[model samples]
Target: MKKKNVISVVVTVVAVIVAVYTLFPFYLVLMNSFKNANDIVASPVSFTGVNVTQWITNLSNVINNSNFNFWYAFGTSLAITVISLILLALFGSMAAWVICRNKTKWSTAIYMTFIASMIIPFQVVMLPLISTFRDVGEFIGVSMLQSIPGIVFAYCGFGGAMTVFILTGFIKNIPYELEEAANIDGCSPEGIFFRVIFPLLKPVITTVTILNGMWIWNDYLLPSLMLGQNGRVKTLPVAVQAFVGSYVKQWDLILSAALLAIVPMIIIFLFAQKQIMHGMVEGAIK
Candidate 1:
């Protein structure tokens, strides 16, 4: 009993330490956001100069600045993220179902291809991706380099592999008997998938949406590359960079913008975190 108690206490203490370490950066950002540049420069970690008026002033500066049009950026980010998640969830589940149901060498090869692509980092293909998109956009007579649809399309492609991977694992464990029964009932393949299979994917779909939402919302590199830093269309992450200058860095405005950008994702995670865990564990186990 004593040995178990000693180990449990040690584990709890370690977990608490890790939690604090991970959250310390966020704490600093939040704390410093409520202080002026002088107070932040004097002692960033200190709580002495924290005030609500400074907080409002900083946030107002970020919001009202022409460079950081918060509302427009927020809308662009929301549209791209929401549209991308919907498409990924729909197409990913459909592909996973088809792959899981088929028992051919081709299906296995395609699954392996997706898994292999996951190992390749985005940096490896980013430049190529840009040129390809530019050429294709010109060929097709549509602007793919600096558009919302272009970014959403890129997200779907980048996010597709992992979405299919997770859903495939979970689908593999779903009893084929359910699908077989639907087939015997004279349902079409499309009907079987949409009416039967897709409904059962809610929990896992929510998981991928949240996962992809956080990534797409917080992503800076892809958006920065596709949508130029000073582009008319900008996501929150891209717009936040406006506070930073070549020589003069606005720490107060930067942190305030960072705070605004993260608040939505934090609210979402707090609410759907349970679903995320449940879906992940179930997908892995089954």
Candidate 2:
């Protein structure tokens, strides 16, 4: 009993240490966002100069700043994230249902292919992806770079693998008799999927959506490459980068902007956190 208590204490200490380490950056940002530039520079970690009025000023400056254009970028990010999540959830569910139901060698190979792609780093293909998008855009007479549709398409493609992977697992545990019953009711394949299988996917779909929305909303590197850093089209993450100039950086406004960018995601995760956990556990077990 004494040894078990000692082990529990050690584990608790380690977990506390890791949690603090992980959240320290957010704490710093939240703390310093309420301070002015001078206060931030002097004592970023200190709470001495923090106040609601200064936080209002900082947030005001960030929101109204022409360079950041918070509202415009907010709209862009919202549109892209929403559109991408919808497409990914819909098509990913469809693909997963098909793969799970077929149970053939081809389906197995295809599922393995998606699983393998998940392990590959995005850095390896980013450059090639950009050029390919450019060429394909020109060939097809539709601009694929620095545009909403283009980014949405890219997000769907990149996000598809993990989405399909998770959804596929959940679909496997769904009884095949359900699909067969729908078919016997004179339902087409499309009808069976939409009317029957799709509705059952709500839990896992929520998981995939929340997961993908977080990534697409916060992604900087891909958006920066696809949409030029200073281009007219930009996501919130790209817009936030405008605060850092070549010679000087505004830590106060930068943190303020960072705070604004993350608040939505924070609220979402907090509200849906239970669903997120439940869906993931269900997917893994099923």
Candidate 3:
């Protein structure tokens, strides 16, 4: 009994230390965002001279600055994320359902191909990706670079592998018996999927949505390359970089912009954390 109590205390102490280590950077950013550049440089670790008015000033300056276009960037990011996630969920679920139900060499091969594709680093394909987008844009007479649709397409492709991977695992655990019974009741494959399987996928779908949503929201490199530095289209991260450059790296404004960029994602995770964890565990176990 004494040994178990000692182990418990040690584990608790380690967990607390790890938690503080993980959150310390975020704490620093929150603390210094409310201070001027000079004050931040003078004492970054201490909030001794921070003021509420400074927080308002810093945030206002970031949001109101024409270069940053905080509201416009926010709208653009929201639209892209929403559109991409919707498409990913629909397509990924459909693909996973088909793959799960079909017991064929082709389906197995295709699933393996997706799994293999996940291992390929983005850097390896990024140049070709850009070139292909450019070429395709010219051939199609619709822009595929520096456009919302183009970015959405890119995200769908990149996010598809993992989405299908997770959903496929979860769907496998769903008994084939339900689908068989639904078919006997005169339901088409589409009906079985939409009315039956898809409804039951809520937990895992929530998991994939949160996972992909966070990635698409905070992604910087893909957006940076797809939407040029000075392009009219900008996500929050890209816009923050542009804003920082215009301000000549003024830390207060930069940190404020960083804080603003993360607020939406933080809110989303806070609300959905339970669902995310549940879905992940269910998918893994089944």
Best by lDDT: 3
Misplaced by over 4 Å in model 1 are: 1-18, 277-286
Q: Cα lDDT of model 3 overall? A: 0.91
How does model 1 fare in lDDT? 0.88
lDDT of each residue in 1-286, candidate 2, tens digit only:
9999999999999999999999999999999999988899998788979999999999999899888889999999999999999999999999998898888999999999999998889999999999999999999999999899999999999999999999988888899898888888899999999999999988889888867876888899999999888988989988877656521567888888889998988887798788767765655453
Which candidate, 1 or 3, has the higher TM-score?
3
Q: Between the candidate structures 1 and 2, which one is better when assessed by TM-score?
A: 1
Clashing pairs in 1: none
Please, what is the TM-score per model?
0.88, 0.87, 0.90
Model 1 agreement with the true structure over 7-51: per-residue lDDT tens digits: 999999999999999999999989999999888988988897899
- Candidate 1 clashes: the total is 0
Q: Per-model C-alpha lDDT, please? A: 0.88, 0.89, 0.91
Q: Rank the candidates by TM-score, best first.
A: 3, 1, 2
Model 3 bad stretches (over 4 Å): 1-15, 277-286
